[model samples]
Structure formats: structure tokens, C-alpha cells
Target: MKQKRSRYIIGIDLGTTNSAIAYMDTRKNPTGGADAIRTFSVPQLVAEGEVKEREGLPSFLYLSTGQDLPVGSLDLAWAKERNFAVGEFARIQGAKVPGRLVSSAKSWLCHQGVDRKAPILPWGSDMEELSKCSPVDASALYMGHVRDAWNYLMAGSDPSDRFEEQDVILTVPASFDAVARELTLDAAGKAGITRITLVEEPQAAFYYWITDNEENWSGIVGPGKIILVCDIGGGTTDFTLIRVREGDAAPTPERIAVGEHLLLGGDNMDLALARLVESRILGEKENRLDSLRWLILASLCRNAKEKILSGGDVQQVGINLPGRGKGIVAGTLSDSINMEDIEQTVINGFLPDTRFDETPVRGRGSGICEWGLPFVADPVIPRHLAAFLKKHAAEQMDSSRADGRFPLRPDAIFFNGGVFTPRIIRKRISAMLSNWFSHDTDPAFQPLVLENNSPALAVARGATYYGMVRRGRGVRIVGGCARSYYVKVAENRAALEPGQITAACVIPRGMEEGEEMEIEAPEFKVL
Candidate 1:
């Protein structure tokens, strides 16, 4: 008889564009060592009739007709006869037919104005022709895939072992509100995940960095060092400011600040490229692209942008368009995304060299638009980062050091998410940031850019490290609540006025997880 596998601690990063899972066997690292961290090559269907294990599972979900695919083509170890694909195949096929693809469910998860529980994905798809899933349901499906992959990988070795029984750490965006967090928990339950601890994505990324520099984390990031975590993912760009302070035993890391959750990221870049392509293609002909055609073009531009960005030496990335009614080839309407396009749109447009005081400008309010994910109108990333720093500068640092010119400054920076995979992007941001810090007195002020390997898989790996730390093994970041929780109280006893409502902080910043707090204030009626 074979020896049964031991229980494992798993980490799941349910990202916007891609999702991943990592695990650590308790038997291998009985003491919860840092070397015990390893990720699962998620087994997913890459093609119509092919399945392969890959580093990260694409979050795109494809709703297919029951008769469209052959038997077992869409089958996984734990699922069979599924009329949908949830990984690599989903992304590839969905790009070709945009009407059936459910993308950016994570973004929709936080759209409180809209009904997240409603089955309205595949945004503008004809329901009679294509299947539909709710944003919550879509998220649950991705998590379900991760859970099933883990169980199948540990099949016969541990009959009693299951993901729901283990210590599982799931990561969410730091800016997710109460409703969104509760909905995430609900999704976990739907995915058969019984026991789980929610960790913020930015915090998870920091944990991975700490694990990477385990031996010298204390020495490297000493006391008073402010580490900025710039997490620009496929769908959103998040910033977390972690300040290291000298503890009784070792240096403790605390999440001092978290920026506003902006719907600005690689998706914006893809859309920008798509518009450029559309303009160039339409200018050559008198015909305009319909909604369906425009969606297809956007998908094509996204693929082209990725290829062009990844290919450092390559000058241009060509996109092939499907043939129209006139006599033409499928590749006739193809467009090329050149290096100049990337530098102009991404580097200059998104990551401009802006002043520390400059913030993103809100545009004039417009009439009601289509019911979709609310994205930031402005695409300037540096301005947003600067604005976030400016907001926390006065509170985080001493007023004496806070001159009018330089309000907030970070000692170190850690880049995370698939958006930072390209070296050009990393270099551009670093150079621009360093330039911002350069002043009259401090001409040589340069913030350290911490080296990170496998940016695509860092969050998932870090989440596993966080899980290990939770088990009382490695050095942990003592970060509590990133932001304070507040409750509103109406001032006027009669009619509500403009300045009637005032918010009282309940869970203050840096409040540790699992710690309870009691609000001590004047008696107020619960409305």
C-alpha cells in the first residue's frame, strides 16, 4: 500500500484576468519553513480537445452550446459534460467570439450600483444564443476550478484530504467594501470552500517578497523604511504603503495606507490600443465597425498589445481580422501595433512624469451610459500614485520632513501583477519615480526597486507564504486593517440635511485581524 499524503496549506489568488493556486505540504515542512512554498500548475483545457497544466489559469469563462463541443473535450478530473470553459481555452475561444466570453467578473463584483448577483455576464450577449452566469457565480466557478484541481492532484494519496478541510488563504483587493467582501465569502461557499481566511492582495504580494528575502528581510528593510507596493493587474491598479517599524523582537511591517480602488490598468491600455486600431482601420475604408465587430477588434488589439509588450526586440505585432462581405482574405483588415504605439500610449500617456502634488482630474459628469464596470476616465497611473502618496503624506510622516514640495516619499518599491512582467514598464516607472524624488537638497534621492522573479506568479506564491505564517512558522508582517471602518451618524434629529451625516471610525487603521473593537461614543439611535 502507498503512503498517504499529509495535509497541505493552500493559497488561492483569484485575480482579475488570471487565477492561480499554490500549496505547501505539512509533512515536508513540519515547522512551516520558507523553502516549503510551491505553486500548482493548474490543469486546464488550453484548446478544444487538449488539456495541459499551466502556471496561471486565465480568468476568462466561455459559455458554450452543449452540442458545440465533443464529449470529454471540456471535461476536467472533477467536472464532466460542462457547457463552459474556465481557463486558457476560455480566453482563446472567447477572444474569437466575444459574445460568449465572461471577462472582468472581479471588477463587476465590486460594482455596488449594479446587481452583482444577477445573471448578466457576457455583457451584451443574446441570452437565447449564449448561456449566462452572474458575476458572483463566475467568480465561484474560477474558485471551484482551483479547488477541483487541488483535489485531483492529491487523488489517491489522501482519500480524506480536501481543500475545504485545509488551512486555505484567499486574497482580495484591499479596497473591497463590506458588501463586496461578504459576496466573496458567499462565492467561496458556492465553490465548496468551507474554511478560508481572507487576505488582501497587496499584503499577499508583500508576504511573497518577505519570503523571497527571508534570510535578510530585517536587514534589508530596516526600521522607518516605507515600502510602496504598486500592484497593477489586468483589470485594476492598487497601491499599498507598508511602513517597517522596530518591534520588541524584530522589525514589524504594517499596512499604513491603501489607495482608492481605481479601475485603471492593462485593460485600459488594451482599450486604448483597440481605439487606435479602429481609427486607423476605419480611416482606410468608409465602413464603420458594428458593436460585434468592435468587440472582436478590441480582443484582437488586447492580444496584439500583450505580444508587442512582451517582445522586447520585436518592432511590431500584427493583428489579423476576419473577412467581411466583400471579397477579401481573413487577414485583410489586419493592423500592426508598433513599439512607437506602446511608448506613446502606455509610457507617455499612462506613466507620465507628473508632479507629486498632481492628481487625477475628474471629468464633467455625463448622461447615463451602458450598464458596465465603472472604470476611471483618466489613464494617468503616475498621477494616481502621486495622489495616493499625497493623501497619506501628512499622517504617515512627520510634518517637519513634509515640505511643500515633497509631501510623501517611499524608501523602497515592490512591483507586482502581470502588468509589471515587462522590463520596459518596470524601468519606465522606476525612472519616473526617481525623477520625482529628486529635489534641490536631495539630488541623489533614489528609491530602491526590490527585485522580483516571476511577477505573474508572485501573488499566489506569497499567499502560500502567508498561509504558512498563519500556521506560526516564518516571520510575519504585523499589518492590520489597511483602512479604518466607519459608521455614519445623522446630526439632525428631524430632516436630513447636506451636512447632517458624519462618519465615526469603528475599526481604526492598523487594527490587527481577529481582534475585536468596541465603539465608545454618545448614544445614537440605529436608523
Candidate 2:
């Protein structure tokens, strides 16, 4: 028996807040080209019993109580008698019933302290009747939905065209550790996608930029130039620095550094806006809102934030919180969020001007702590960026700088993520970067912005292009392990102290895939 050839190469962007799929027909494009790649519109339940197509699927899952909707409302063409929902409808309905909603699964998947395989999602929920799932389970559900949707729309009656049989590339955060990466692979395997390759989200975004500018990318970026990839998504912020060096044919790009995983992004901004509105509506003396009500308010604030930052003419959006009793309309609490509130709360709060040497302030931890997803102590994005640059300055510093006093200054910035959709927000971040550089060395130095055609879809599209590149199609960015590894060694003595253990570098940073290195360490004898 012979194996069937894959008809397509697919890329999946399993984002924290939303997910997207892109693919290229191998049969159609024997010789791959960036123009041949296309985005797939996913069919999902938009409302009860109604199915519609959307470009991106919201990464939220709602576990139904079997009484929330009408019969056959949750049914899909691929499955029947369903008790759960994923995508747009899930996000919309879960906002009202926060106890049953599984959100930020990606963030929880990377959390080290918690058992990712344990059923602890909908964290801190007290609902006994509702079913709970693990962080890995939530991710697998999302991936399985994409697989079913693809088979239903593209496979037709041909079993060979199923998504599981295709060459797939999935994107993950660059800062994710080995445990997190392994968990992600487990989720994909559970979804029936065993043949898959994982790519860093930041690198995928850079690949998309290269494919988008294949004609003139070499002209725009020459040798010895550093490009900073700033990725601020719904639930996480990632920073990567890439350097362009001269190659045999054209300039080659190499990834030099990646920042630590910081759980701070649009979700944090939404919560901040919600708190601002809550304070205005309920006075300081009023009782605080319960957990359910707080989640509902945050959802409403998310909608308002999108509207205000959408570059529309609307100045404000109204928020109406439903009461728990029968007379809901009469007991409803109402408030409005204006453009001013958005600017003061989200823009000024997260992305503010700061000096290059200034570090992010770490808040004091309480004696009694709670077990949950570990969020960043400081929410200032600029401060975090400054710290990332300072840490990697020695390796990426320009040869012209002999003083070694200034941090690594990027020649250009490539912004990718939904958080950077608004022109005002992008300009604010650019201005902040420019201010920091001007104060450091050159007064006229300003990092150029590499225009992204679509920030929301870049990762998926880039992943697909990378799949093609693996098949001998396009240029590949040289990047491997994001961080170095170390092993603890004890001192050879008759009596050892508690503080005598030291770590030896086993694997150096930037070691490419498939590369081997010899470690010189004493061998231990087992009894």
C-alpha cells in the first residue's frame, strides 16, 4: 500500500483571544508563490441555530447546561446533539454567563505552577453543575473545530483531503518554555493533527512581511540592520529582534533575542476600562460588584473599546448591565464610555513615554497568594520594551557604538497583533520608541515602521508561507531555541552546603534546530 499525497499545506494561528486558518493548494501552485496563499473563512454559529462564515474564530468556549438554547440550535453539519459551542457565539453568550466560560486558555497553558492537564478552567468558578475542562482540553476543542470545519468545506467526499492528512504549521509564542511547547503539541495530537510543525508567532509575522515585500525587501532592509518585531495580542505581549546580514545571494535574516513571556495585552486594557466605568457608575461607597457582574462589565467594555478605537465617528458607547431578578429592565445599571475615557485608561495607562534605562516597577507581593494564571506585576508596555532592549544590547549593538552606553537601537519595527490595529495607538508606540532613541545617542534617529497589510491575519498567513518555504519555496528566517539551558551541579566535598549548587550552561542560546553540541560534565555512577 502507498500513502496518499497531501493536497494542501495549512497554517493555524491558535491565538489566545482569536484563531485563524490559512492554506495553499499544493496542486494549484506547484511552484509556490506568496500570491498563491489565501485565508480560509471559518463557518461558526453566530447566533442560536444560525451559521455564518467569519474570517477569524474567537478563542472562547461555552459549556452549555443543556437548557440555555432551543433544540437543534447548537447543531452543526459535522456533528449533532452538541452541548457546547465555540467561536463568535461562544464569546457572545459566555460574556453573560461567566461561570461556564473557558477563556485565556493559551495563557493558562503556559502557566508553570498549575497542572495544565487538570480540569481547572473557568478558574475560580463555584458552579457545581457546570462541566469544567483542562487548559489543554480547551485548546484541543478549538483545534478540532477548525479541523471539522475544514473537512466540511474543502474535503467534500474525498477522504484524502481531510485536514489531518495535510501538512500543517501551528504558531506559538516565542517565549513559551519547553513544557508549554510540549503541552501545545499534546493538544494538537488530541485534535487528530499528529503531523504538524510548530513555528514561533513572532517569526511567522516576520515571514509574512518578507513574503508581502518579496519584490523590494532586500532594497528596504540592507545588511547590519536590526528589525524589532513587536507583537501585542489579546492576552500576551512578545518581543523579538532580527538582524539582517549579508548572504551569498541576498541579505539573510537571523533572530537574535526574544523577551520573557508577559501576560499583558488587550485583555488587561479592557479590564482597566471596565474598572474606570465601574467607579463612575457605582460610587466609592457602594458595594463592589460580584465576580459574575464584573466579568459582564468587562465584556461590555471590550465592545466599547473596539468601537471607540475603530476610527469611527461615534464618541461614546452605552453599557447596560442586566439585573438578576425578574424586573431586569427596572434594576438595570447603565453607563457610557467616551473617547476620553479610552485614551486616559488604555492608551495613557499601558503605552506611556519612558526613558531607556528605566525598568518596570515590580509590585510588592502579598503574604497570602492566590493560585491562578500568573499575570505581569507591571502593565506598562513601554517599560517592558525598554527592559528587553537593555538585556540584549550587548549582542545586537551596532559596531559603530564604541562607548557601549546605549541599548540596542532597532533600524525598523515590524508590528503584528490585533492590539496595533488603530493608527493612533501605533503612532503612540512609535513616538515612544523615537523619544527613547533620541534621548540616548542621535537626536535624529527614528525607527522605520514596516507596514503590515493585515495585523490580524499576518500570523496565519506567515505560517502558511513558512510551510511552503519548508517545501523549497521561499526564504526562511534563521532562528532556533529562544533561550539557553543549564544543569545544576554540586561541589565535590565531604560535606556540602545548601548554597553550593551552581548551574552549568548545557546548551547555548540561538542553537539552530538539528545542531549538536558536546557537554563536558562529570559522569555520575548509578548503584
Candidate 3:
């Protein structure tokens, strides 16, 4: 027998608007340990035209007629056309053909008062009509994505592949809330993932930072130090300050705590810009005609966003607003809407250019007009931007020490998020960081500890790399969360059962991580 090899650790980057998964196989490096890990990432978007109801795929499946499926990539049959809309309950929704859809259910898990499993996608209502889904039926939705990825890997397995050794580490935003984390763990379980862990997005990036020190940063943290991690992505922003240290005891680099601002991200910026286009192009006429008009609007938002990213101004917004009394709204999307209008829509209404805490910042004019409706001038949009920036600054400060603690700064942030990629956005963020650490003088505070080098894949790469570390370490104890389940030991075999303890973990909670504490299982059987 050519002994089957146990292998692979899957890392999922589940963002607000986009998501991806990367894994490592031992074949990459036999001599090196965890450092030999490799990675691959694809947008979590499923296109309708290529949908196919396969084993791991979600419903609304599409197949590319007769084409061989692209195994480790997004089925981009409809990527060229995508739009964002205010769904049924005014929630921002994106349109997808039959099986083509993208979701970041990870972000919705933290809504206050509302059930995390409730229909929370922006267009939950309208989509309910389209898919004839229940008001709160998200079970078959995003969960299907997990299945899809798992199945994708399984399908590629050879007869000699030993899946028993495969493990998974899920990267969640550092700021994930209680219910949000719960729901995500639920989703992971639903995906049939038996060995899964949730690592803060920033922390995962840190592993990458530690791995590629010298080239990416000034120096690595000497064993113990405090570090701040800021990750801005498509749908939200996550920030955390952590202490970094290495040990194989059981998932080292203790995650002190993480904080986040719900619904703050580049996607929001896109939304504001989209709305600005709608206001300028449609103006006073939006009460008429609507067939493929929705589709056209989607295209406009995508185009306008691209224009801004390209370092150029868009003159006209091509929308399909028919019968709206607005003369050129439907017919003309070419170079017609006057670049001035687009500029104001962004600069004045969407994301107003402004200053924060005496530090200057920039926002797309498109963001200004889109976010600031009835769009007033004289510090209109800038005020909103200022509030957001200030809120983040305050949150970071509040989370810095966490009750009289000099946790020590991290060697480097190990930064990786969508916002870090765009050249313009990167520069803007750099300026903001300049202001953020202007006061720290510990010589430990990294001036600008970030990894713009490999923005999106950083987290996935770190995770995949780390997975290689546990190859022969036996069954390791991944962090535990509520409503979560792991195989229980019985009959000398593992049995499936949900976690029992609800009180903020006992033994583990009471003693220092390195110190072991005896625990007596308290039972209160629910009737």
C-alpha cells in the first residue's frame, strides 16, 4: 500500500461582500514545517450561468452548458454584470442569475435583537419573492457555499488522498460580535466541517507578517509585545490589538479580544456612489418604468466604481431608467451626465473629502452625494465621513489597553483586507495611520505595521501555512464557541453533539492559558 497521506488545512476569508478559501498540501514541502504552506483564493461569488446542482454546490445551480468547470476559481459567467440594490427592507442587495450569488453571512451574525439566522441580506425580502424563500430561511443559502468549497476539494481528491488529517481555520473579522460568531460557527458546522477553527482576520494576517518579516516590516516582535490590527474590507471594518508569542501548547497567540464597527467598509462606499449616480441620473424622475432597468442600474454602479478606481472622473452614468420623465436617464449613459455632476455626486454627496482629528482624509466625491442625500453643502458629506473616522479612532483607543494592560504592541499588524489593495485607498489609509500613532513613543509601536504586499490573500496564506504546522501534532484543541459542536468521545469513537456549557467557559476561562485548571462539568439538562 502506498500509504495514504494525511494532509491539508483550509482557511476561509469570509468578508462582508466577498469570501475566499485557501489550503495547503504537504507535497509543497517535506523538509519545512508550517512555513511550507501555499495558498489560492477566488471570490466567493457563484454565477448563475455556470450553476449546477452538484454535491457541494448550493441550489440555483448553473452549469456552463458543456464546459469543464473551473475547479479552484469563481464561476464568472455573470461577473461582468453585477449591481447593488436596496433590497425588500431597504437592505443593500446584489442581483445574481439563477445559481450565481455572493454572500457574506458572516457579517450579519451580529445584529442586535434580531436573530442571526433571520433573513439579513440587504435584499432578503425581494429575494424571498424571487427564490420563493422563507422570510428567515438562510440555512440553504450561504451554508451551501461552505458545502461548495468542501465538495470542490473532495472532487479533486485522488484515491490515495487521506482527508482524515485535513483541518480548517476560519478567518472572521476581528470585530465579530457574539451572535455573529455563533452564527458563523453554525454555518461552519452545517458545511460538514468537523475540524474547523475561527481566527481573527488580523491575527491570521499576523502569522503571514511573522513569516515574511524583514522584507515586509522593520522587525518582528521579540516574543511578547502588543500590536494593533486594522482590517477594512468590502462590507465592514475590524480592529483588534493583540499580544504575539509562539508556542505549540494549543493554539498560541492568545486572542485577547477584538472590536469592530458594523456595516463599515469599501462596499458601503460603493453603495453611496451607486446612490449618488441614481440621484444625479434619475434626479426627480424615478417613479416610472422598470423591467431590465434594475439590471442596467447595476451595471452603472459597477462602471462608475471602476471609473473612480481608475484614477479618472466619470462624466455620465449609464442607467436604464425608462418612463421616468427624466429624459436622458434611460437612453444616455455615455459621456452625457456631465462629469461635473458625477464629481459632485461623489465629492459633495457620497464620501465628502474631510479632516479627522486634525488629520486630513479623502473620500470619493461619488461617496459624498450617494451617502449625503438632499445633499447639503457647507460640511455636508465631510461631517459624516468625519464621524465614521472618529468613531473608528475612538474604538481603537478604547480597545488599546483593555482595563489597565500594556499588552505590548505586535511586531507588525499582518494587514490584509480589500481596502489595502487599491493604490489610492492605501495612500489614504497611510495618512490616516500617520495620525493614529502620532503619540505612541514606546519604540515598540510600529509606525505603519501593515502588509499591502499581498492584500486579500494574506489571511488565507497565513492560515494555510499554519495548517501545515499541525500535520503530526495529533488532534489539537481548536477554540470553542457557543451552539457549536465537536465530536464527543464515546464507545472509543467520536460522537456528534452540540456544546453543553453556556456560561462563559469555566476551567479555560479561570486559569491562565499555560496553566491547567481542573473542571467539574456542571449539568442542567434542558427539559
* Model number with the top lDDT: 2
What is the Cα-based TM-score of model 1? 0.92
Model 3 misplaced regions, further than 4 Å: 1-5, 27-35, 40-104, 113-129, 132-165, 214-226, 243-257, 285-299, 310-414, 436-446, 469-527
Q: For candidate 2, what is the TM-score? A: 0.93
Better of 1 and 3 by lDDT: 1
TM-score to native of every candidate shown: 0.92, 0.93, 0.61
10 residues in a row with least lDDT, candidate 3: 84-93
Q: What does candidate 3's lDDT look like per residue over 1-527, in tens digits?
A: 53334455677666554455566665656543344655542223433233332211111212121222334233333233322111111111123231213233443455454455644333223333333321123433443444444455553556334232356777776656555666777766665554666666776776666556523322344435545566777656666555444556422344444553445555554554555556555557654224234433543564555565555554454444333335554464322334454446433443344344432223432223211221112223223334444444443343544323221223344445765554654454444444443344543333445555666567776666555544543222223231222223233223434653234244342133235544445443454
Q: Which of 1 and 2 is the better model by TM-score?
A: 2
Residue-level lDDT of model 1, residues 73-131, one tens digit each, is 88876787888999999998887777788998898898867799999998877658676
**How many backbone collisions does model 2 have?**
0
Ranked by lDDT, top first: 2, 1, 3
Best by TM-score: 2
The better-scoring model by lDDT among 1 and 2 is 2
> Candidate 1's error at 168, in angstroms?
1.3
After superposition, which runs of candidate 1 have C-alpha atoms over 4 Å from their true positions? 1-6, 157-159, 284-287, 324-332, 364-371, 488-492, 495-499, 502-505, 520-527
| CA RMSD per model (angstroms) | 3.8, 2.9, 10.6
Clashing pairs in 2: none
